[model samples]
Target: MPLALVDCDSFYASCERLFRPDLRKKPIVVLSNNDGCVIARSKEAKAMGIKMGVPWFQIKKAYLANGGHVFSSNFALYGDMSARVMNILECMFLQAYEVYSIDEAFLDLDTLDKNFNLYKFGCHVKRCY
Candidate 1:
């Protein structure tokens, strides 16, 4: 079966940045509850060598020194953003899609047009965001 997976990478940081556009293109990292660990990181943050699950204290000084933005985990916002993506998928796929996670989904491409250009279609789906 032809299947397609849609995943929103850096979902938590992406959600945070949505609210703070000033931090767009900047390094961003989301911390777990109690500000304990690095849970989500933006592309910029990852480029700075911040690894997932690293204790906050371990990288705080250097990260801030390089102008990284830190956000406390905000699950509500992330869930809402995820819902938006899922809604778009539902509209596009009808009932031929299954939600994989808050940040991921799967679509049954075999149910789509037989002449579908998978690469072009995938590009369109990605640009839906």
Candidate 2:
């Protein structure tokens, strides 16, 4: 069985940006509970050298000075968003799938047509949700 490992890249950061278009191009980081450490970061944030599990206070000043945005963990919003993505995959691929993590899923492609173009299907699947 051909398995496709589908993971949401920068999931927390991406979820935070879903409703805020202004953040689309900015470096973004999501702090852990009580705002102590960094948990997630956008691609731009990663490029800016913001690392996971780092103490937020250590980087707050420099990160803010360089136009970075920080957010507290929003579990409700993240969970709801994750479910929607999973639903899309389940509906399209049926029973041959597994939710590997909150932001990653594994889909079995054996149910698909052998002649199907996996590359194009993968692109379409990504755009689905």
Candidate 3:
């Protein structure tokens, strides 16, 4: 199987920004289940020394001081973004595929001829969403 796992660098933070206009340029963190801990942090947040999996209460002060936005996992928002991204993939490939997660998918592109440029294909995928 010519499968590829295309993981986004900071998927949760990116997904959060999809709907929250104000979060685009700021540091952001997504908490884990029950909003108990930090599961994801943006590059901006990481630069501030916010470690992943830190308890929310422990980081509350730092988060606020650093202008970090904290969001509980909003599966709905992530799901919608995932769908939008996958729909873009569906348009480019010719065969069966399965959405593995909100940010990943497996597509069978066996039918594409030798002329298909995989790098350009990936770039087009990146641009689509």
- Tens digits of per-residue lDDT for model 2, 1-129: 778888998999999998888888799999999999999999999999999999999999999999999999999999999999899889978898999999999999898877879889778857864
> Model 1, 1-129: lDDT tens per residue?
978888897899989988888997999999999999999999999999999999999999999999999999988888899999899889878999999999999999878887868889779767854
Model 3 residue 18 CA deviation (Å) reads 1.6
Candidate 2 wrong stretches, greater than 4 Å: 125-129
Itemize residue pairs with steric clashes in candidate 2.
Answer: none
Ranking of models by lDDT: 2, 1, 3
What lDDT score is found at residue 48 in candidate 1? 99
Ranked by lDDT, the better of candidates 2 and 3 is 2
- Model 1 spans with C-alpha error above 4 angstroms: 125-129
User: Per-residue alpha-carbon lDDT of model 3 for 54-117, expressed as tens digits?
Assistant: 9999989967986889889987877887787788777766456777877887877675677988
Looking at model 3, residue 124 earns an lDDT score of: 78
Candidates in order: C-alpha RMSD to true structure = 1.6, 1.5, 2.5
TM-scores of the candidates are 0.90, 0.93, 0.77
